[model samples]
Target: MAHPTTSVLCTELGFEWPDGTTVLDGFHLAVGPGRTGLIGLNGSGKSTLLRLMAGELTPTSGTVRIGGELGYLPQGVTFDTARQVDEALGIRAAREALHAIEAGDTDERHFTAVGDDWDVEERARAVLDRLGLERLGLDRTTGELSGGEAVLLHLAALLLRRPDVLLLDEPTNNLDRRARSLLYEAVASWPGVLVVVSHDRELLQHVDQIADLRDGAVTWYGGNFAEYERTVAAQQETAERLVRAAEGDVQRQKRDLAEARVKLDRSASYGKKRAVTRNDPKVFSGKLKRQAQETAGRVRGMHTERLTEAKERLTAAEDAVRDDAEIRIDLPRTAVPAGRTVLHLDHVRLPYGPRADLELRGAERVALVGRNGSGKTTLLRAVAGELTPVEGEISTPVPLRYLPQRLDLLDDTLSVVGNVKRYAPAVGDNAVRARLARFQFRGGRADQLAGTLSGGERFRAALAALLLADPPPQLLMLDEPTNNLDLASVRQLTQALAGYQGALIVASHDLPFLRGLGITRWLELDGTLREVDPM
Candidate 1:
């Protein structure tokens, strides 16, 4: 069904940070009923756009209009620990009023509060159940839930609202496979307008359309993520062909202009010789020379204009081609011998999971997969020495580093280069910069503050720091590394990893990325770790 004209509309919208960094300018968008996947590179204002539509942010210029009530789910969900589940769902007052009426306390205030939501409790429970939160009673505190559970609970609240328009930003970043599936089911059945900004390919597959945000403009494509990819591939092919044609045109124009100049020179020479041989009157010769010069001027002007237009066309065609750089580096120091044992775990018991044992050797790559609320993060933390195991032993004989999902390892006050220096204090400034260049942080970008970097840039900086530490990590543990990365950046990361000769353990829900890693083993972490062929 077609939504109202104002379901979610932005007219000449613009936004800029306090530091005068423009996120969006003169942006115009109108979304109707159906799912739309808003995708863009990191720092391209996907999240900012969602905030503007949800009224969490005011645009610097223009306007945002919503025809009906709107619901928003941000990347992170924060709430008071003591708040009850019903309160978070926004049905506490109505539920309380209904309870009072049931208890025979027919106060006028209670009757007024109950109003039209007499079944608010039942609806809230239904939403919770749909999101796999059936065990979470209305009395449960927010603090009792895990990170993934908290995100799901917030989404459940939004679902209960039944808004005319809903906005979700990176909704599946914290979710596991099961939680993601539940969310996808909910999205597929959404009755109102839905807009999602995410990097999760699986979630994007459920979208009815793709809205690609690039260079401050939105390009709409009809169909799911797969269809969008096919369309973009075809467009890129056409663009490359156009670029080749434009290049040929410019070359031809240059040749024509050169030939025209030569011809004019020859014509002028011939006229001069003929004038001398015929001994024409001085006035007639002068007029002939002036006329020849004017004709030459017009010819040159016409050729120059054609050449200029051809060059302009070439530039436009080149602009249509994307040139996103990839990460390429050699990490010879990170290599380990085939028989080297990087990590060994003997009946390790984590805080919330069962005992597990593991032995990693050489440059083996392992993928850790599990559902939400599982102890995947916990296990990685224990190995990284961030958390203490309840029982048994864990050992890492060589240098190790962990890149957590939050990416809080780097100091915000330091520059990108400075952060790397912090990790590899012995490396010289010039050497550090040369190494960072491989991560795509060159020149002034290396000097930029960590706090000011975008999501993708920050991830690159963190990876550089870890891989280039004082004693290069032989065992690198990454948690959801592709969470906020654009497709181009993800490819860059995969290419970078191809050069790392170390034992790698990555915990992620991104199947495509794991498949690209050439994983030697896949371990599913439920209560215990077990080998599984997820592929």
Candidate 2:
């Protein structure tokens, strides 16, 4: 159903928010065949651009020319949980018709539904296999699948459309390692024009090029995310060096201009004394003074121009340098002595999932890795006292807190300070304000409603509540802490975790992030928890 043009073009594209916030200004882009990875910070307009291209949003003052059929998979995919997988794939009617004819129920309407492409079921299964969903039954309701599985299911449906242009936003954010591998294979085999907006480094590595959106502009880099990172790293290094050279040049120009002025003053004074001592003619003395002033003005102007140019160059160079600020915090009284037993679980059993025994001593940093539905989240919830084990003896020597993936710990309607105060009722308003400021919520920012906060801000607010609790949780558990976070925010979280002197068990699929946390133990949950070598 696609035209022969097979190209996507945005000519002088412009878009703006209803609140008078300009998201994109005069952005132009031309995308052709092959996979293109669109990447940027959390709010760098990557999603906005995708929406514009998908025709879900109309550009305020530009034209979008798509010369082919399109299919879009949004960041948050929702489906009718009651619908079967076949229904979700848009093939239930065709499949039913095919089965009806085989059963000898010769209805003319059923024949029409079959059409020419009678292998809809085969094609559907193939796509599901490609996306690691072959194990999921076509007749099963969508509610039966896990969160990661649900995301893969939607992607499978999109791929079955066979569109000339495919737009995906953070498709791999919820996928596990195995599912990610399958998605990577699909990307590698894709032949049409593919454009995906994602922060997953592994997923971006499969792209033919990377489109970096920053400051309302798209900068193209050849090759994948790795190549983009290398290119930017090289540029920043060169930029920093140029800045240093420019600064030196400006200082030298300033010194030269001052020296020239001093010489000119001395010359004028010497000429005046000479004209008076030699009894020179008045006209000759006047001409000499005029020449001296003219020459000094020219010298001063030249140096001033050089200094101005140097300053301009310096500013441009400095702009290219990265200035990622680190998060710093103090977690007082959250420390556990080296020999203390922080947690002990004896034959702990969840209502569903593997029964296991575990223990945490002192300030051990544990990395919990597992596939979706493997009970990683359930275990964390049980530890946080949100859920009780069906049967087992679990003991905790200190206060514990859990940060779920949804970040529902804070009330959206309340201010960030109000949420933190809920956990620390005894702490006065002044003390709470002081603590929130350390979490980067200073003054009026601390008074902003949790619902109005950005993704990173909301995460920080939820974390602050846990940290400022009355008992000061000595054991912390986080589930997919880096999900949907920008790179800078991930770094900020790493820095914040570095300051927490407590027993930590973090369940996440981000291996790089777990390594950054300095994890002392690695636990994989399949049917049971087992400590494994990180390598």
Candidate 3:
């Protein structure tokens, strides 16, 4: 069946703060009944516009019209600790209400009399099956569920509400590859109007259209992420050409104004001498002065107009290249030769409850691929010397750098540059500033408190500190490095890893990223670590 006409229209929308500061201005958008991917840099008003569409925030100056009911999933979910998966889905309440209505015991004042025919249990089951939670134990506590499982459960609950439109913000942050694939599949088949705010390039490829938000305005494109990128590149080139042309025009205008001023000065000098003389020999001195003044005024006006035009063109060009500078950072350099044995594990056994053992090694770029709490991070910790082996001796080399899944090594109170200096004291201030510049931390940003930095910025700072040590690490260990990174940063990091010569042991569910980095070995963690042939 065709989907309903669920759309949103925002006309001349303007949102401001209490201090009379405008964040979004003259923003016009038309959201049709299809998948629309919203793309922007951080703090670009994507989240705010989504909330406005969901009716959570009213626009300060314009109207937002929603054609139908809307379902929203914010960047994070707040779970009720006391509620189970099923109870959170409202399945129990729906069941009881249906039962009461069918048994003719429901309050007539509370429920409409459309009662006994409703198949609430069957409907709930259908929705659960569609969401891949049909076989799950509904009474399982929310606290016990893994990150991906909890996300799927909450999504199921939201789908059960049957809203005409759905809005999701960064919905794939903690999802593994399997979970992400499942989500994309579900959203692809969903029959409602969907607006997604995300920086994941792969996810954006699945949408029908892209709405790029930049400079407080939205520009629509009729294709996926790849097409959008190509269009933006072309636009940047055009803007650069315009900037050059404007500069040339300004230079020409300046030359013309100078020549005109000289001519006017000569004319006035001659006219003044003629007026002072007793013999009125000039044909028309008054006309000559008036004409010189008009010419100078016109030249001045042209100069002002050319300068304004040049500045406007320069601003456009700068904005076009602003987002391109972020993906240029160099990864930590490692001089360790390739194919060297950085670490080895023999007969290693890690216990899980009572009867399981997990083994891992540094011989492969192993992806601890499984649901959360499946000993992936635990295995990495063991290799990093953060956790001791319970039975066998785990061999590891000295001068190894381990980037934990969480940036716990960074001191929150210290500035970014201060943290780097403290961690690697031998690095000079100038060298540290230069390295920070590669990571897009120039000017006063390096002096900002580490706690105030965003997740991506913190990750960059931590990586900078790790790589800038006196002697570079011979082995590199990273856990979920791509978790909070935007797509461009991930690409840049992957390229840098491809060039690194050190031994690598990464624990990530990002399959595409691993493949791009030329990971050649695989270790599956079941009860033991057994090497498998590379894919």
Best candidate, TM-score-wise? 1
Give every collision pair in model 1.
none
> What would the per-residue lDDT of candidate 1 be over residues 257-315, giving only the tens digit for each residue?
99999999999999999999999999999999999999999999999999999999999
lDDT of 2 by residue, 141-256 (tens): 98767778888888888788888899988787667789888988888788899998876788888999998877888889999989999999999889889889888988988898
Better by TM-score, candidate 3 or 1: 1
Off by over 4 Å in 1: 1-4, 264-292
Instruction: Give stretches of model 2 more than 4 Å off.
Output: 1-6, 264-298, 328-333, 410-472
Candidate 1, which ten residues in sequence have the lowest lDDT sum? 1-10
Error of 2 at 321 (Å): 2.6
Give each model's whole-structure lDDT.
Answer: 0.91, 0.85, 0.71
| Highest-scoring model, lDDT | 1
Judged by whole-model lDDT over C-alpha atoms, candidate 3 comes out at 0.71
- Model 3 alpha-carbon miss at residue 229, Å: 3.5
By lDDT, is 1 or 2 better?
Answer: 1
TM-score of each: 0.93, 0.87, 0.73
